[model samples]
Target: MPEAKREAWITGVGIVSTLGEGADAHWQKLSAAQPGADTTTFAPFVVHPLAPLNFDAQIPKKGDQRQMENWQRIGTYAAGLALDSAGVKGKPELLSQMDMIVAAGGGERDLNVDATILNGYTQAANPAAFLNERLMGDLRPTLFLAQLSNLLAGNISIVHGVTGSSRTFMGEEAAGVDAVRIALSRITAGQSDIALVGGAHNGERPEMLMLYEFAGQCLKDKFAPIWERGDKGGFALGSLGAFLVIEARDHAEKRGAKPLARLSAVVADRASRKPGTITETLGKLWDKIKDKVKGGQTAILSGATGSTQATAEERAFLEQHGELAVRATATYLGHGMEPQFAMNVALATVALAHGSLYPPSDQTGLEKPMSGSLDQVVVTGVGHWRGEGMALVERVG
Candidate 1:
């Protein structure tokens, strides 16, 4: 499949996080720099790495949060907004024909919280007492049917009455992109008319942060705020949710939905095990798909995770695929948080649709090639991506 044959488009957007309650608010604050790294205590072990880092959270209005688990609340909240933006209004017909493919990169369940609640509920002898304890916050639902890891997909399917396909995938960060790639394949092959593709995560869980730290995935620095923390933490923890409505060009046009950008290609190669293998892997992916992103309205939407390793990998891709002058926007959208990679891809889809590129955060000091060859958004929230950085990269041959 050469880059010349790939095709897909982004027709909607949605987000819910600390940055803002809805997509527009979230995007506005995300586009600007602020105090994003102030740490907050979630549970005993859970330490929120940054202020806006837990963008998956919302300021529960009045009495809205006590009924749902944290994950369910956030996933449902964000997906609903995304569907609305995509013009999906709980239509039974559209949903039954559409697919729901949601992916995440980390543990979907808050293990620490689960253990605490399950222990309490199991020990209570009186069912009424146990129920009362649960209501009183002492014995939580051990079988919190709402918080199952795959609830994102399940809830989306139920909310929209989607009967086509409902499942979740958990893998490496690159897995988020893989989910979209799979969706594109199904749609292009004429298996479906519309696909609801999204990524999300609630970053407030302690166990999740521990995993990140254990893997040496924490931001490299200790900067404190969105304005000042740019140097300390390579990227602060920030909540993010993104969804895109992808349909065949003809179908989109017939439905009168605005087309943001067409999907070109999303290529992933095994990360090299060696110190410099990332560079080589990136180069290979670029070489394999450069033709797809070449020509009119083409640009690279880098998966800039801010980790030195991730940065190096993407940097190598730019060097080899420099003809189009790549650009990055993650630091602008904030950290992907819990469902790390899924949220990143969701945001990337939006970035592609709007053609707005975000500059790397000041924390990592992602410099424009000293030669200024690659056109990048080096400042905070530069409006819509100027020109078409969203290129239909040539497919891998």
Candidate 2:
């Protein structure tokens, strides 16, 4: 006889975003319908800056905090929060064995170095040599190493002692979806007993804004609810850190850890995004998990970055399943790139644990108020440009 598959539970969640830190703070902010966006900081371009965090609380070592860039510090801090939430913070045994998966983008660029290179290269007689010289001299030796996406996982291991197997995924929104999917898959298959998974993004950089602006994807000037962006759609880059501690049901039970919610299913897909492709891909993903949803007790936490075409397509997909109460988190939290999906999943776990969904922020009437007991949440991630994914998070009895 074949051995039965194990179940995966969301045992811990650590989130820090524009709204605030931890599950309680976020829940309170959402419940009150207050957005934490900053339209003036990076003006003409709107951004949701991270709430002020005292890094010493989680990182402890000032040296560790100093060496890491802002994004690394955010991710490591969030990972520590997850460990604390899971009751494994100082447990050497658990820390030694807890596997880790992170979704990350390339590290922040040095604006000064970039500006110098651009300004000098255009004026220098030997532009090629000037560029090469600047590349060799102007860039810090450690900048190259710091830019590696896996460094976030490495920093978590160093600071939090989560030294188990580590894997890093690097494709923006899809990376966040895959990180959770793989972590849950490993636990459910009994290959792993516990894992820490999530990602972080610092979207307040000039270079990052410019990079996205090149593609015409940055939300500018006025900040509007994601659904209201309509034809003038773009994403307000957000700075956030999100991490979750997921464990096998038996493992959590053995450790006396209570689950916030059960991760029942996660499905990810990529469509060409040619007109109706996203809607079609989302339809297929929905079909796989739709049966797991119970009407009246279910809601959706949508990871819809206000990027033009993708947001519209996601809205269309949500319209197809109008019965489910929907909330586009990007409207409040802003878009945190690689961490968007994980952040939304964490929010879903929060909602299921609380047994209620937050009131809608949309004035367009697309998002309606949900009442009564909330037992399940279908977290949707329609990537700004590429991937589409969904997860079913259910209340644990």
Candidate 3:
């Protein structure tokens, strides 16, 4: 089959994040500015652009950290919601024929099995060393099991009776999109009629925070020290799990499914990880999308993480498209890491399906345009000019 001939439509979705679990809560949190992202925290002296963390937006009680690793909690919760959205919940027979693809990075760093093993070895060698190694401590084997990314697929498969092929990928921020490409390719090749595609990452870890800080990528605020030092649009740290059910359009319709939007096209490329080529890569994506998007799309759900380089390039792309409106959901979803783009794709599906824009996080007095606006960084719920609300924009390769 040809690339253009391959078609996929989203029939369902699920999300699990600091905004709380379930699709309804996810929609509510993103559709409006929730009062949680701004809470203050005194845990560590990390330089946050919106630091002094005023909102108490940590994981909710239902998350049950004692039973699952952060990644597993996010992955499973999101997957369940996606299956529910597709109306395939609790039906193992329907999912048994589908393929599964899960994405994530820094998988289970906090659940360090290496340290545990080292302690175990020392304890076996010397009984007294057990005390020093804390080998007798209550070690939760379940914690280690929860750390594997595949367990995410396993949980969903067991619930849905998905006995077909399964796969997982890792590459930090790029894993989410890669998972989509893989799933789409498999369907195009007739490997399966449906797929559960998504990416998962945890922000509650010190590594994600450390990496963000080292990169100097916090969202800018009036009080952030990084802002005073000339850093702008500082990024926020938050967790996200986003998944979509991708199936052929005809198949979806035959099953009485309402598609959010047609997966008309998806393309990605990589250059050296530097500031200069990010725009070029996105431009390449635009090129591939130009013909498909030109007359059909009125809104662009950007993966802009509010970092200096990404935001600048995205702004440049919008600037060239004079009159094409843009809507960035990350402003509301918090700083998305791996599978971040998947979350944005989900938000786009929501807008395309419902014709409603999810509002952006208010950055004090900053009056930005909803990325939906032509050549501007427009925020959502401002003066959004709702167009046809279809994903018709084509890539101009």
Candidate 4:
């Protein structure tokens, strides 16, 4: 006979965003429908900046903090939070065996260097050689090393001592989906007993804004709630980090770890993103997890990036399942790209543990309120351009 699949539970979550740090602070701010976006700083393009964090609290060594870029520091700090939440911090035995999966974007660009090169290149006698000289002379060697996507995972392992196998995925929002999907798959398939999975995005950067602006994906001018963005849809970049400690139920039980929520299923799909592709892809994903959902007791935590077609199609899909309560978190947190889906899953676990969904903040009438007790949360990720995914997070009882 074949061995039965092991159950997977989300035992710990570490999250830091514009709303604040940790589960309690987020729950409190979200419960009050308070948003933490900054409209003036990156004006014209709205952004949700990271809340003030003291790196010393999680990363003790000043040298370690200085070595990493802001996003890496954010992710490493969140990973430490997850380890602490899982009661594994300082437990070298557990840390040594814990596997890690991280979803990350290319590291932050050195804008000053970029600007200097751009400004001087056209004026030089030999533009190519001038550019080459600036690239070779002005940029520090350590800057290139710090920009590697895997460095976030490396820093986490170094500072937190999580020395197990490490994997990093990069594909914008899709990376976050796959990171959690793979981690859950490993645990349920009995290949992994315990794992830390998540991602971080530092969207408060000039290069990021410029790149997305080229695609016309940055929410500009006035900041509005996600659903209200209409045809002028664009994502308001967010700076945030999220990490979760997920383990096989038996493994968690043996360690006396308390589960915050059970992660029953995670499904992902890539659509060509033609006119109606998102809706079609999401319908197929919803069908796969619908059987595990109890109509009235279930709700949705959407990772809608507020991009024009993507948000609209995801909204259409949710409208078909109107019986379920829905909240598009990007309205509050903005969109953290690589970390968006992981952050939503963390929020879903938090909502399940609290037994209540935060009140609706959208004036668009799309985010209706829920009355009864909350038991299940279907977290949805319809990537701004390419990926669609869903995961069912339910109360552990």
Q: Tell me how far candidate 2 lies from the true structure as C-alpha RMSD in angstroms.
A: 1.8
| Candidate 1 structure quality by residue, lDDT tens digits, 1-397 | 5432324665555666555555456456545634343343532221233223232333234233444455555665666666667676576766677777776543356466567666777777885687566656743454354545576666556554656776576653444555666777777777766787766765555566666667555553343322222222344444456565666666666677665445555555455345566666555554655543433334454545555544554465466544443445454444563344434444555444345543434443333222322222111111110100112322211
Please, what is the TM-score per model? Answer: 0.71, 0.97, 0.74, 0.98
For residues 216-305, write the lDDT of model 4, one tens digit per residue: 999998888898899987999999999999999999999899999999888999999999999999999988888778989999999999
Error of 2 at 69 (Å): 0.9
Q: Residue-pair clashes per candidate, as listed?
A: 31, 0, 52, 0
For residue 249, model 2's alpha carbon misses the true position, in angstroms, by 0.5
Q: For this target, which candidate reaches the highest lDDT against the unseen true structure?
A: 4
Off by over 4 Å in 2: 1-4
Better of 2 and 4 by lDDT: 4
- Span of ten consecutive residues with least summed lDDT in model 3: 380-389
lDDT of 3 by residue, 1-397 (tens): 1464556777777766666665566677666655345434514422212212111122234434345565666666677678878987666666877778887764566436446666576648675666445533534566556666677777656545666788887665566667776677676666668888886666666666655667676543332311122235555656778888888766777788877666665555555536545556556666655654543235555555566655665556555665554555555555556666666666666555545455544443222344332211111110010100112311111
Ranking by lDDT: 4, 2, 3, 1
Please identify which of the two predictions, 1 or 2, would achieve the higher lDDT against the true structure.
2
Residue pairs in clash, model 4: none
Alpha carbon deviation, residue 349, candidate 4 (Å): 0.6
Off by over 4 Å in 3: 20-24, 33-36, 42-67, 109-142, 218-233, 295-297, 359-397
